[model samples]
Target: MNIVHILKKYPVVILLLLLTACEEDGDKIYLSGLEASEFILTETDILLSKENASKIVLSAAWKNNTLVVSNPDMGAPDVFTAYLQISTQEDFSSNVIETEGTGESKAYTGAELNAIARNLGLVPDVATPVYFRLRGSIGANMESAYSGVKTVYISPYLIDMTVGFILDKDKQQTGLTLASPDADGIYTGFVGATSWYNFFMEEGDGKIWGNLAADGSAFLASSEEGSWNFWYPEPGGCYYTEVNTVRKRWSAIYLPALEVSGDITGEMTFDRPNTRWYYVFNAASAGTATIRFSGQGDEYNYETGDGAPAAGKVTIAFAQENGQLVLTGAAGTISVQVPAAGECTLILDLSDPKNWTCEVTSGSEEPEPVAPEVYVIGIDDGITGGGWNFDNKLYLYNEDNLAYAGVLNVHSLWGYQIGTEKDNWGDVYTQAGGDAYSGTLEFKGQNNLAAPAPGVYLFDVSLKNLTYALTAVGDHVYVNGLDDKWEFNQTLAATSVPGVYSGSITVSGASSYGFKIYLVQNNWNMLFGGSDGKLTYGGADIPDSNSWSAGTYTITVDLVNRTYTIQ
Candidate 1:
């Protein structure tokens, strides 16, 4: 029985005995004892209003109700340390402020309590109640129960200001000037009263002019009326009004009106009897115009008809010449051609009791012809291999057929659609049958076209022809195999020469693995796989009968020749 033999046999027994000895000697032991009793607070409720918040002090005092430890050797300290906690919530879950107690008393100055109220996000002039409690501790890990909760009602201070609206010398009172106790006292309240008058505020007196800051003033005007001028203390600045003709009101701000100058063109046709026609044109600098005729009217009615003339077809032509728009047409076709000056409407009074009269009415112009806008559709989902990002949008490649073409990587069964806008699904093109991909694509349909297999397929969607084609790649080729960890990430890059991609890769082990050539990395929708060293677009996986042994292989993919070699 040597020391080594004895220690190996009784290691656990020896360790337990040593721990017991140390515990008995009080080296690392703590004697269990009863906890301190709950404490009692002197005040449980307090009011901290804005009136008294600046003058009074917030204080709380607590008394220890439990019996004190009489033995000095028990390792308990006299006079327990206490902490006062203040919080906005009743449970004090967060945003709590802790204040240490001076013996049994804790005090907060008026300014301190007000800061706490503001930090709790209490609105000015609004009253909010906060909670407080005292927690006492004797030593590390020894805490007495919490004292009763106390509440403090606090309110913030608010400022008061006066606002008024002054009327101009026009003697037109826009509206009543409202004076209220709870008003926000902003300039919007004054200008919002009426749409005709512009309001401004002066510092000393309302009658004084040029004293008001331009930033502090606001104006209202009508939309139908392009520009208007109003006088405040001085002449209110001339501001273009944005008048809402529908609502018969204007915005609170002023904007300049846009001046337009251009030639106007329009057409008119007479089809019924006793029908009056009126048109207006705004000539910028007087240019030539062409008015062609197509329909004919009864020439006899123009000379004999009294009130409510009989229906007739008329041939007419209008041209801007000699600084005037002249109308030249066959007689009994039109009564007048020339129009009055100034922006006015040409009134063709066919309702005349004796004869037809045509004259200008007011001022206007015929709108110009606008060009059509072109919008490019976008490919979304797994089709683009970039998810549904609009930055990778597709465009119309062939206008004649109305076909949209873009490079896309399709999964075997994953579906996608074309959208009018990027990242927006409100308008899209889907396949017919609601769940099948056939026939033609419909707007906002439920079904989407799926790829026949996993690979990269060129998408040619023709809306005009109502057909789509998925062309596999024989040129822009890619190699996808076990070397890519069977994922899209490890695709081998190919060298482009003429019409084919050729590259070489090293096979590391003799373990069983399969690979194929693809047009896109990680895209299994279209691939080239075949037997007897022959590669075809969208064919089966290669090496049909046997697996290639571990070795470095040089491969050449010839899309022009439609062949491949491995050596």
Candidate 2:
């Protein structure tokens, strides 16, 4: 065969014969000239950063002669495996990192190089020299050959300190975590506690951090393992907490409630994620008055800004002092103009702790009041009284409740109308056509309200919610505390009025004339007494004051209006 064809047919065998022709041991195999060759590096100096973590930072390559097997007659073997060893020591005596592959060159990314550098005890952001060497191994039983060491200067960056777990004083995880999106070492989140509690923060690297001072004077933190835990001084509520590892400082703002006091007064709802407190302010009349923001055990007075209480939106200006959002001026001195008779929304935004602001914008106004005269008009259907007459009149017995109730004998397929005026068809209320007896009430619709079934129902209408309901009426109620007996003995019969019950009871043996009303016999779940001189569900006692005198009295219980009276 020609030289080219012979070399191609048994290239490994010819190369081994030419390199190790004088060797005699049949099983011996080795790589020649590996120790004498230099290990080449693409970059002798590199600066590593988290921003370029995935980018290729360094590359290493070395040349080694082909494997030489003593017996040319043996089967030819595949390419040898190359290993890249990295170490901080010049002699590579300890802490060596080894990586293997079937190639002559190896490349590393910034993150991989940074990790290796950190593993070698190199300080972050500091440039240090590391040693690299290449080795080649032919087979499992064969000896390996290594190349000379190459030094490279590398600067590593700190890993992400963004995620940390909030642990209780017992060092147990609380399932609450804080994150620094920017990875700037500042973590923020809200925590709720039932009482005074102490907590600690454990970083993603399993390093626990706590307050530097044992007493937690200013909420400063330390990385020491034995540091004291951060604590809440006040009792039981929600708080906005922030921790800055860079500055070793921390702060917790107690936010039990946010309220607006003075001319524009109302409670504000908390928008936790946005760190905002907002409430709709209604202007009864146009005037100028000094208004203040209160809650968090302090008052926030107005400083300087044109965004005062006006007809449109106005943003109030604020500043930060000592890491807390504070009002510029003294309390009760910041006078603002109130908008004309209209509604306005007031907002206090502390989303940015350094810059706090208040904004006033247009808001919804209170709705018009509904007239108290509401009557049920429909065909009698034999069970009800007058035919096509407004005889079943619903009464708003309780002004505070703002609902009308009355009993009506309804037919399964019958339709009804709730009218404002007696015998007036023009002023009536109808709903969307349906058999859903309990639903919203429409001022005027294409169809009348359909009855759910044929039965005596306690019909109820809520003026505030613009809704209606039809509940089956119970026949009677159980009365207790009569004649000083705790057990129920007297019963009040339900009247034609939806929830009204009347009965005559003699309180002769009772030391005090007190009683409780219950819907179910021997059941306290649906019970009622008196609260603030009105019948209340699950209230303390009848008469509220518990000072009723013994006598024979006619008792009237208005369950719908939540009121009771003894005549």
Q: Largest TM-score belongs to which candidate?
A: 2
Minimal lDDT window, size 10, model 1: 13-22
State the lDDT of candidate 1 residue by residue for 1-567, as single tens digits. 001111222222211000010132544433222222333333444444434533546666554322223333543334456678888888889888887777555566454565666667766566677788766555555434455566767664432223223333232333323222233332222121111233322111121111112222223222122233332211111121122222322222221111111233354422112233435665343323223222232211112221112233344333334433333453222223334445654444333212334444446533332212112232334444454444433345333345555444345335666666555666777676323223577778776654445444456567767666666553345556544345554333435343356656676643232567766655665456555766644444555324566677776765433477777
Error of 2 at 228 (Å): 37
Off by over 4 Å in 2: 1-290, 293-375, 379-414, 419-443, 451-456, 460-468, 480-490, 494-500, 504-541, 549-554, 558-564
- Work out the TM-score per prediction: 0.22, 0.33
lDDT of 2 by residue, 1-567 (tens): 111111223222221111222223654443232333455678888999855665798977554344434345654455556788899988888989999944556788886787787778888888899998766666566556666778889888875567667887777776666667676878875555433357898765446778785431436778886788876543334455678888887766555675566667777776533446667766777777555765543111112111112122222223434544464433333345556667876666665533456656567422334455588777355455445677667765323235676555565336778888887887777874335568777776767777666655667676556678776646888788766566866889988775788998776644343578877677654566664547654444464224545667788888766678777
Least well predicted 10-residue stretch by lDDT in candidate 2: 298-307
What C-alpha RMSD separates each model from the true structure?
A: 29.9, 20.5
